[model samples]
Every structure is written in structure tokens, then in C-alpha cells.
Target: MCKPLSDAISQGRVSTEEGERKVWAALEAAISHFIEGGLVTDDLMKQLLPRKYEHWELRSRKPRPSLRVFGRFAMPDVFVGTHVERRDRLGAKWSPQWEHQKLVCEDHWNEAGLPAPFTDQPSFLYERYITSNARQKIRVQL
Candidate 1:
């Protein structure tokens, strides 16, 4: 997690305590799944389109008040979370929010001097960065 995201989580900006807890649980499950070499599906993690954003979101969609954590992959499996927001709050005007989060991530990458995020076909990225399980899932999408 980046400083801003960490602070947001710590400061209870996600929602009520219960909402925060749910989001935290979702985040932890996603992290553990990724670290354990499990196949992560789109429901838990999704890459933003247009490729220009180069952003991915970790989603927590249950228990109402869904949450989205925006970030970029620092390396193969290393995700640097930069911002988080509740889905309900974003409402229908979510594109601008996504753009803002993407900028936040890019700025963080520049400030930290991290290498550029991986940019390639979803198939290629899955093949190169993650385990083979993702190949089957991505094939259908591609």
C-alpha cells in the first residue's frame, strides 16, 4: 500500500467501521490469494481499459457500499496501491474519479522512481507476470 492509501484505510475514510472491516477483509483475501499463486479473477481485481491509465483496481463488492482500491503494478506481482474510494459515492460520474486515481498512481511512481508499469496485451501480461492459470481465463476475454 502507498502512503495515501494506507492513511485512508487507517483514517476510516472508506466508510463506517463495518464497511472498512469488509473492505479490509476483501483486500487481505486478494493479497493472500495473489501471494499464494492462486488465480485471481476479474471480480477481485480488474485492469482499467484504454491501457493509458495503466491502473488496476482491487474491488470489494459485497455488503453494499462497495470499495475500490486504485493502484498500479510496480513489478510482476507487486501492486502499489495509491487511492481508495467507495463505489456508491462515485455514482455515475466515475470516469473522472478513475482518472484522478490514475494520476495519483502515476505521480507516486514518478516520485518513488519506480519503473513504468507493465503495458501489453492482457494475454501477454498474464503469461509473463502471473501463473498459467490466468492464461485460460484471459483467453476467453481476448
Candidate 2:
């Protein structure tokens, strides 16, 4: 998600500095409205995770007993998705892609007795974005 709101709009062939400045300005301007009354409270189920683009916030649901398990479980957390552009060429398959970097609630889909990358949320979706973005950029350059 290399913040689609940032590079895609401001860099329609403009300087990176100009693009960052404008995007930051817009973000600053919008913060107040977004936080007026919807601020996260202590009681809210909040998961703060780091992503490449914008920060991800997972709003978990009410907890419940697991039907398949003997213990309780929380609901799947939503990946508050975002993207960020690396200042340098990144080593990942995609350097400029909006890589989903954070694991919200759903990230823990791996059963305690199981391993990673094969949870309810497939890890490849995020990785594929990186790969496809790398290929797309290559195509654009070609």
C-alpha cells in the first residue's frame, strides 16, 4: 500500500520533497477531524502495529469461547492497512510497493501448537503485493 494517497497523487512526476511536504500537510489537516470524537478509549480493543505505509489499528471484537478449542479466543483483528516508500532501494522483491507490514489480530491465526505463515491470513498476500509491485515498476520502467 506504499501510501496510495501519498506518492500516487503528489508525485504525478513531481519531486519527492514536494510530495512528502504536501502529503504531510494534508495528513496534519485531516487529523483533527478524524480524532474529534472517535479517539481510541481505554476500553476499546486496540492493536497498534507497524506497517510500511500508515499505521495499522486493529479493533478487536468481544471475546468468546472457542468452539473448536478448549480455551477462549479473541476475534480476528482487522489489518489497519497502510504503505510507505523506502528512501532507498529496498532488498525485498518490491522496493516501492505498499507492503502490509503489521500483524493485527488475524496475524495470530497460527495455533499455539502450529507454525507461522500458514495461519488464517495467508502471508503470501502481502508478499505477493511486493513481488507484483516490483514487476509492475519494472514494466513501467521498460
RMSD of each: 3.9, 17.9
Q: How much is 65 displaced in model 2, in angstroms?
A: 42
Score candidate 2 by TM-score against the native: 0.21
Candidate 2 lDDT by residue in tens digits, 1-142: 1233234334533535654555444433332322343333312212222322222322222121100001111222222222222323223433322133232223323323222222124232332322221221122344
Residue-level error in angstroms, candidate 2, position 134: 37
Off by over 4 Å in 2: 1-16, 38-100, 104-142
- Per-model TM against the reference: 0.74, 0.21
